[model samples]
Target: MHQWRTWHRPLVLFAAAMAVMTVVSGVGLLVDDRVLTGAAIWSKPFKFAVSFVVYALALAWMLTLVTRGRRTGWWAGTVVALSSFAEMAIITAQVVRGKRSHFNHATPFDESLFNAMAVTVVVLWAGTLLIAILLLRARIADRASAWAIRSGVSLALVGAGFGFLMTQPTKEQRAAGNLDTADVIGAHAVGVPDGGPSMPLTGWSTTGGDLRIPHFVGMHALQLLPLFLLAVTALAPRFVRLRDPRVRLRLVQVASGAYAAVTALVTWQALRGRPLIHPDGATLTAAALTLAATAAGTYGALRTGSGAHTSPSAEKELVS
Candidate 1:
């Protein structure tokens, strides 16, 4: 029982949950046969729920260490956990409100609940990623870790940024000229539609999907990019002579550029009032850019064979 308190326990649990989420999400994708929405028919909710649980448990254990004055990984993990919970809350609300359906629109319930929650999640997510970046910088002496940190941070910002702004309502005036006070009163009591569509569901373009879909795409960029970065870093060169000092820096730059391109494309889609499922020229362009960056990163990593070495630094010591 005493041994369970060690970092390995929670780390293993977190890793297991993540693995389950990947498998579950993949299966859900295969079954659903639809583009993955933030609040999708399957996968997204379960994944978020699992992530929330994992983060909660990990956070509790990490915070325990913090309270006991153990500082090393506590702060970073705590920040990430808080961010995860906030994101889970937002995703849960979207799921509950049926925000992923064909009549996809946020209700009053969703707006009131998730508007503030979404912003909070984005800020916390950024802060936590920043903390991770700084930690990597302090602890890593080699170029590989630096690239990982840069790639991770860049992707997180792009993803979280899209998520934060995606919920804002379109700039349209409220519906007017509707009457039937009795129906309104009765339907309000019975949860029936008194009008043509609910307020949140009303203004959404029927032809085009929601503009917020890009934000969803952007937010997960971090998820995929970091995995690649980690893999590349893990496969380091055997010979010291193969090491490239600039490899990490280049990888980070390519990742940043890729996400920046994504952000721009998402913003363009939002402005055009396009749904997420529609693959237009701009979306294709962004996809191409991301692929190009990925290719560049893969080539650079193979060519340089750079790897990172972690050690206690002035930053770590200060926290300790």
Candidate 2:
């Protein structure tokens, strides 16, 4: 069992840095009165800092779990660490300068910084993909944990890619024809302007659709799915059916499907310029169907585990 001491060094250090930034930014939120794009000026730094903490720490521990390709995984982890730090630095710098970080091209300098951020994002994606490959080829001991890790990485990639959708110029931006003049280009909000009323804290669009919603949901699947698997494992003692490895794996598959559906659903909703808080009939119906399907799938998986493959003693030891 590899401990934190043996986890990826660069990633752990990066996570530690981000943890400090998280505390600093959180304090800034309480003291600073500056606002950016209808949110507190410190908001971007705080959110990004916290995200890096979760991502870097999780990635560090996960790479330690791999039995194969440790060297390649180390390189991948380093790439992710460096790129993550670059992206966070840019955001924090922009925040301090009273400027927007993403989708901003008001000045030639800002455009250059944004371009750099784009490069970092591409590198981050590639690095994550390589890590996924390592995880896929690893000789994992637990089937449930393996499935969770693999499926989580797959969904995370899909989620992170959706961020690119926001970079395309909106119809209004095209019609306004201010792109050449170095006006702001691209936006997170679909129907409304970027700086309109937003949800508290997260700064998510309230008046119109926001692409960030889906992007966020997708990216955190890497963490959420694994946590879900852990919860199931923890409850195995109470729920006899969950004691089986096969049942847990099947549930992970089902959850992965459901998670992907949510990502796609929110994406479709946003692209259609509909606010998440105000879902129409189509979205509601689709959500209902997804929930029903997941319920049925869970029932089926539980039924299969009725005839346990191993004795109770073996099952208890396996879970423990």
- Tell me each candidate's RMSD, in Å, in order: 9.7, 2.3
**What's the distance in Å from true for residue 62, model 1?**
13
CA lDDT scores, all candidates in order: 0.47, 0.88
Q: What is candidate 1's lDDT per residue for 1-320, written digit by digit as tens? A: 25445653444455455556557655664676543232234546565555445434433332332222235455555556555555555654554444542223245554445545655675566555544445444534444444554454455555556543433322331132233211111111011121222123122333343444444455555445545555545554664422333554455566666666766675676566554445688678877877877797757754543355333463243223
In the range 200-304, model 2's lDDT, one tens digit per residue, is 878888888999998889888889999999999999999877878778988988898889888999999998888888899999999999999989988887887
lDDT of 1 at 4: 49
Best by TM-score: 2
TM-score of structure candidate 2: 0.95
Q: TM-scores, in order shown?
A: 0.53, 0.95
